[model samples]
Target: MCKNMKELQTVSERIFSLEQKKAQKKKEMDELEKEIKMLKNETSSYMKKRQKNELNIAGFTILFTAFARSSFDKDAFIAGESNGAELYRKYSKEIPMERVTVKVAK
Candidate 1:
């Protein structure tokens, strides 16, 4: 019983240490992400001002282009069309999934 308790205590301490490290790394990552976003905005602005779509420098190519994406409105289609609901049910398939998570208390 004493040995088991010691093992549990060791595992719990390891989990706490890992959680602290994870939090520190997350903070560093957030700062880096912010800097990257600022740099990208500056580069994009420069490209747009020069009326350029692509820039090749230091063996890297950056593309700044405009595009349109098409998306279907399921609810609107179902309301507007007579056979929309049936078509949606016929095309859509439900898949079973299992997710596992571990949460440490602060």
Candidate 2:
């Protein structure tokens, strides 16, 4: 009977320790989520304020890229393009505006 009691106490202590660890992890996750939500909200607001370019315009078309050897994150440009649209959409919109044909030799 005494041996059994000792075993039970040991297990209870382990279980309690595990529960505390789990609670701490949960608290950390909640904090991270809150921070991300705040940042996303701020970025989204910027997107809303500006009128995204639906159609490409001749004057608006970049016309030509400097083509200088510089590396920038392509992903960021596509998502938050000049007028706030993808390269494909921006090019298509140019038809109505008769965009200036610029050679991109790179």
Choose the strongest candidate by lDDT: 1
Once superposed on the true structure, which residue ranges of model 1 sit more than 4 Å away at CA? 1-3, 68-78, 81-106
The per-candidate count of clashes, in order, stands at 0, 1
Q: What residue pairs clash in candidate 2, if any at all? A: 56-93
Assess each prediction's global lDDT (C-alpha) against the native.
Answer: 0.67, 0.52
- CA RMSD per model (angstroms): 13.0, 18.2
Candidate 2 at residue 19, lDDT? 100
lDDT of 1 by residue, 34-58 (tens): 9877777777677768887766666
Structural similarity to truth (TM-score) of each candidate = 0.58, 0.44
Task: Name the regions of candidate 2 deviating beyond 4 angstroms.
Answer: 1-3, 52-106
TM-score of 1: 0.58
